[model samples]
Target chain A: MSSITSAKANVLVVGSGGVGTMAAFALEKGGKASVTAVLRSNFAAVQQSGFDIKSLDHGDIQAWRPSAIRNSVPNTATDATAQPYDFIVVTTKNIADIAPSVAEIIAPAVSPGHTAIALVQNGLNIERPLIAAFPSNPIISGVSFIGATEEKPGTIRHDDHDVLLVGAFANPNIAPQASAAAAKIFSDMYGSCPGIDVIYEPDVRFTRWRKLLYNASFNSVATILRMDTSRMRISEHVIDDLIRPVMLEIRATAAAAGVELPMELVDRMITVDTFEAFFKPSMCQDIEKGNYIEFENIVGEPLREAERLGVHTPALKVIYGLLKGLQWQRMEAKGLVKIPLVSEPGMKYGSKPRVVT
Target chain B: MSSITSAKANVLVVGSGGVGTMAAFALEKGGKASVTAVLRSNFAAVQQSGFDIKSLDHGDIQAWRPSAIRNSVPNTATDATAQPYDFIVVTTKNIADIAPSVAEIIAPAVSPGHTAIALVQNGLNIERPLIAAFPSNPIISGVSFIGATEEKPGTIRHDDHDVLLVGAFANPNIAPQASAAAAKIFSDMYGSCPGIDVIYEPDVRFTRWRKLLYNASFNSVATILRMDTSRMRISEHVIDDLIRPVMLEIRATAAAAGVELPMELVDRMITVDTFEAFFKPSMCQDIEKGNYIEFENIVGEPLREAERLGVHTPALKVIYGLLKGLQWQRMEAKGLVKIPLVSEPGMKYGSKPRVVT
Candidate 1:
């Protein structure tokens, strides 16, 4: 990966959505290399226009010119505007949500020994498809701890701290180097932004699974009930009655995944009593905007994963069924034009939803 | 009461809010009584023209005439511009949410032996203060099961099978009689006006608790997640992990109140979920309209009841805390001249929230 480090590096940050934009802006601000931000829509306007960069101490809707691209033409392979990149950061909001579109697009850009690619999204098994596609370039499976949203297209409004966990997909030796390189870039970029903490996680998959505990707890409860994160957090009924059992099931699955998380981590999830008091989750936001939620992937995929690993996920099964039904009904309402409604009610999954009653 | 009932009751359905106007129109069509439909401020225009009643079934916007109470004198004794009421249905939305002084405007009109005040709104408890004010007036507490929303300030867009649960303040004799009276009147009203199925609830308090289960299970979840009812009901995780436990907790508290619900009540709640695929709940509507919710009463009171009865409610508690915090934050943002641009991490309420840690 000398091309990305040794020579003058041209980084292309594709899918300039919420997370993508955050990463692109961070990389651009790093000033280590030139980063070209590519988006799918009229996002350049949002980028060019001053948007609020909110952090713990200082938050202002500032403007920055970060060499933006909105799905237009590539200048040329040899030209500065259209030249091939030394490194590519593929950050698509639910790009994997609709199959292998991101992999399909980014696979062409990977220059083998020249560039390295990183995925900053949720769920496990993200690296498999990309690694499968390239097999040559070092692919990093990363987990971003920051919460981000865009008011306009390019203007990313950062809410939470910017922390990251990165690890090599196949090659474990390159992970430390990858993590250090990425950290150096991000630290410079987001130094002014409050709480930018990064942890070089060697066991990226296990770390991803550990984080699943958080998502499974919040996502299932929040989605089914259509609540924001804070609401789910502050609720006693949610914490003790609802989240505990669901979390316990998640823990079981995590254990089955061969990942071991500390009890302290589990406890932290349990005691989050003040969340619903503020902040709306992405899933809830999606529902509010009448956009599609990643119910199947968020709950369904994990349960399937657990089942494959011989894990017990009774509570998750129930939640999965309910969420699936909710989504299916929407499809049915459009004159059965979309998806099937009421496949099953949760208890267990993959074997069909067996009605408890 | 007997005189008005015998001589075709003259009812003043005051407060022409969402529930009020619908009741006014319904009572007028019931044909069992003459209704003087009154709006708080817009009564003048309604008096000049008429009221619009929109129905989903016929896709028709029907008009109706009422002896308007705009700039009219208020004298229950005098039958000139006003008349003695048999039943005065107070359909103010979330009146319980407001301060006692604000919500207590109708205390003077609700005289015992002259008027019967029925609260046709969401939430379980209603008649405590009303009963204290007029013990002899048969302070009937009817929880309306109809799914209708006021399209305009004075217009009711009747959307569902017009169903209502009519009962009274837990008293054996007073409860069923009021329910029966209202039921018969509602049945005869406008040839059941697109099917007004008013059930004669023996104990409306029980019915309130019962209907509350649906609200807590569906409304709380749907509002927080910003999804329709079907979306919520479909997810297995939502159903098992989130909803069922909440329902069970609610059931425990209801049982503690010496109430025994049918085994299939939860199933029934899910069955009725088909109609609400795109259904935006009243709570979400209220939030969107920049109005405070009946959080303390609808969600909070139920939680309190559960606590008092020693029932465990984790999901509900989490949801409650989340909504409460959100409402508070929104309020703070609105009231504060210069608001904080930064926000807490969406992951703050992760499955296992950081607070619990």
Candidate 2:
């Protein structure tokens, strides 16, 4: 671990999509941190032409580049050449992949005691695995209220809200001093960045649950219905019958898990006018692009937790089943999984007796 | 009412689509009944060319005509010219419509004590309103295990099994002798007909409950998923998690309503080799055509009954909500209902402060 405490910190941003790119830009704009972004598919284009962000808050930023861009995760041997990162920011959708998990991917770059890992993904109970994997490294959980989309490989359009909530992962085993210091350092760096508001929360679970009120309600609904937020709002049946019931169930589930999310959060989530009218949530966008939905991280994990706590979440379970069906279809379309012939009902009964008296 | 029993019985079949046409054909082939069919949009074609049925069992019936064909419902004044129908067969999908209901449509032709109303539509409690409207007329409930589709306006494709179960509606106020005679007479006519088997069921409610085992489980799920039965069968998750639970709830609801649906029925519905593998249920077919779903008749009526009977049907309720959402969307598409702009999340915020610290 690095003993020298430098004024200028090193930050490595992994999975630089819409959210990751924004974080990379913010970190660079903050000037306190030098940022390096790991790109997967568009590494060459982004490296040569830089990242382009057409944002509502920041306006148009053409060809914005970070300090360095690498295509893949750096191994421990390659990591020995550079200074250990003070903060490793992960902004990938928490969908399971063929590659290693986020914790394993960032392991080589994360400094043991000094570097804090900030998870900026949407969903609940995301920090547990990271904490389990790296007990010494401080884990920072974040909930972002940003309406952004990657229009192309190297271009992003930030359409609406740009507020982020960052907090130290509340682990009783970890020293409070270490977690607080790590959270404070990361929060201060993003707070100073232009075109975004960053709130340092003492309890990250609160923010996670709060953001879940919107994500859990709208994401799968939008994807399943193939409707935008505006269309969903316009249908009273969708809002009152489907969305509100789901949010209520989520609140009850959260409470059962000892989170005690306020009923006002559910009320605000249904009533509050925070999002852009035609804005599609990230999961909906994933469906549009035929990408795998983050079912486990977003809906499955929370549902499993609810089941464990003996909370009744009928609405949530229904939504989960639907989303999983779509996910199964997506996997089949992508040839990730074999499409079974079992669903075909026509082939089921093979020319049986035509007449039965 | 006519006390004389004629050598040839007068029969009127309303809404002769797939199931109705087949029934009309059976009655005509029996030679003891003179059949009249009320055609909707295809009145001219059917009157000119006769009704065409391409059947897997009976093979292609190129042009089989009923004794008479009329487009609109004959008023009581027009009905005065002919003998009142001994059997008024209503075979349309039992979806509640904007126009007058099936009971109201067939009111003019009913001969009270002499005329019997046979409901061959798919659903539960369909005999209720008919019984209320035709107090003196015996109501015969029919459950069809026929796999057929109206390929066009005047054409039907009978794909698989063709078994019809007929039973008297067991109303406490009605004379059991009259209902039994009506049911037996109709069953005898269809039983002697070519290419189909007809069975006389003493308890109609039992048959209704039995059919609900398959319809309640597969119909709405297939519609919501926009998938055929074969594809639905392929997903073990969908069958185990969704279809079975819904059937179980339906059984419970039936039991609460003084009807015991066997667990064996539920098991058979899921595993039975009766259905063609690729066959889409009637509800799913309705969804594909953008026609109004039979939510009230199939899912809503049963769900409301369960609620009234203090029976828990969480799975059915979820399916009801989803089907309602889809129905709402269909209504919006058809301009039958005013499209409200309430669901827009972007408009909800109304230019609120972008940043929240």
Chain A TM-score values, per prediction: 0.78, 0.89
**Candidate 2 recovers what fraction of true contacts?**
0.17
> How high is each candidate's TM-score?
0.61, 0.90
Residue range B161-252, candidate 2, lDDT tens digits: 57999989975557897788889988988777777788898988887877787788888888887766555666667777788888988999
- The residue-level lDDT of candidate 2 at B318 comes to 76
Model 2: residues >4 Å from true position, as ranges? A1-7, A79-83, A96-100, A104-114, A171-173, A229-234, A274-279, A340-357, B1-6, B79-83, B97-100, B107-114, B273-276, B341-357
TM-score for model 2?
0.90
How big is the positional error of residue A231 in model 1, measured in Å on the Cα after superposition?
13
lDDT of 2 by residue, A1-357 (tens): 123257767888998888888888888888888888999887888988998899887889999999888887665346665677778899988875334677878887766676788988888777888888787788888788777777788999887657888888875557877787778888889978877888888888767876777888888787777766655666656777778888888888888877888776665666455344566777888888888888677778788889999998887887888788788777768777664444343533323333322
| Model-by-model DockQ, in order | 0.09, 0.28
> Fraction of reference contacts reproduced per prediction?
0.14, 0.17
- Listed per prediction, chain B TM-scores read 0.79, 0.90
Judged by whole-model lDDT over C-alpha atoms, candidate 1 comes out at 0.60
| Candidate 1 lDDT over residue span A1-357, tens digit each | 544453335777776766766666666555565667765664546545733455432355466656646464243344554666666777665424444466777655666555667777666566667666665557766677666777665556676656776665664435456544543443343343344555555557677777777777776666555655554443344555556677777777777777777766767755443433455556666666665666665677788888898886766765665566555555455444332344344423212322421
